[model samples]
Target: MLKRFFPDLYVDSIYHIPYETLKKNQIKGLVFDIDNTLVPFDVATGDQRLVTHFKELTRLGFQICLVSNNSEERVTIFNQDLQVEAIHKAQKPLRRSFKKAMKLLKTNPKTTAIIGDQVFTDVWGGNRIGMTTVLVRPVVDRDEWITKIKRGLEKKILKVYLKNSNNQ
Candidate 1:
């Protein structure tokens, strides 16, 4: 189905997300993809700005979790600042990790959102479980070769998605 790869919302960056609006919608938890979604792939920790934002989200009653397909060493180090529940080698676009993320936050699908920069992994997995999905632009272009290939496919899907949205 078209929803499988289509994000519920698109934004320039995670920093620009309207958390208040999400709260208004009764979204209680968020599962985020670490690399590119929160920061670039090479970054090891959340900067003060990002850490503060995460803290504010927590203050607003949103449980957050970091789910990544990267190694534990990478995800572990990157999560040191935010210090929320985290899972590594998530194997996203698969329902298992998404389910685990929901369990981590102790939230149901309707009240949880999955945020990431990739459609195939993040959006697809979220949609599969009927959870809201948010797509943000990648922080940088230096992705692994596998991801780079998926990005190519994502561009084509985006074109189709745009055409459909315009028609609607």
Candidate 2:
């Protein structure tokens, strides 16, 4: 059903997430999709703003890992300064990488959360594994070709999800 793609939380940006609330909820680990979730697709590295944000999350006592379908070089270059655990070419919406990330964080699904910009990938994948899923609006309107195609379908689902949420 459409619920498979639905996120447990949706926000405008990662900066808008309530880390303290998540901590209180016992969510101790986070798996993040790097490209559009953290930076624009074209951006090659984490900006100072994002680095500081990760530091804050760590200080707040959360384990963090970056999971991306992008190439290893891409993930590596972006992760250089941040220096956290990372999984590249993640092939998300699949249980394997999500499980691997959980292993890396040493946390189970109940204590883990996944944050990303895509519904089919991040949300569906996280929900499948019983991890809290947080969907954030893409960092920029622009997207890679494949993502652009997926976004069209995502728009329809999001419209229905938003409508249903409001009616509640």
Candidate 3:
């Protein structure tokens, strides 16, 4: 479980991820977590940077979808602003939402990547479904109490993952 939570690629920030890398990896689609991953949880609208990134992703021929455990209201707000397909109340770590996103993208699991800030939810769920995962630092360090607890455990797993990656 812990191993699954650690992504194949870990970056300091999502902005650091290069589109060329995804092309090289043959990734044709992307599933992203909305809150904390794309923007701070408290933010109702996406930033200009994210909007530009979304446009560039489409320009590169990669389909994009947003998946969130947040409520419909929250997700809808983001969808309306970002103009992207989104799944609400995703219940991550379960494959249902991920599968739905794959269906919407019309892409195979082998050709998709999942990018998010959480280890337990985004990384574990994506890895479980055989998609490449990219873990990026959260936009905000402050999170819900439950998420904070999960993050604490995730830190332990991340340390080991970093060590193993170095050895590889």
Candidate 3 lDDT for residue 35:
85
Which lDDT tens digits does candidate 2 get at residues 1-168? 899999988999999998888899999999999979999999999789999999989998999999999999999999998999999989999999999999999999999999999999999999999999999999999999999899989999999889988999
Which structure among the candidates has the greatest TM-score? 2
Candidate 3 lDDT over 1-168, as tens digits, reads 457677989988778887688889899988999889888888888878888889888898989999999999999988785788789999998999999999999987899999999998999999999999999999998797889889878889999999989999
Give each model's whole-structure lDDT: 0.90, 0.94, 0.89
Write candidate 1's Cα lDDT for 1-168 as tens digits: 665799888899998888889889989999999988898888788789999999989999999999899999999999887899999999998889888988989998999999999999999989999898999999898898889889888998988887887798
Global lDDT of model 1 = 0.90
Q: Which is the winner by TM-score between candidate 2 and candidate 3?
A: 2
Task: Determine which window of 10 residues in candidate 2 has minimal summed lDDT.
Answer: 16-25
Q: After superposition, how far is residue 99 of candidate 1 from its true place, in Å?
A: 1.1
Reference-based lDDT, residue 38, model 2: 97
Q: Once superposed on the true structure, which residue ranges of model 2 sit more than 4 Å away at CA?
A: none
**In lDDT terms, which candidate is top?**
2
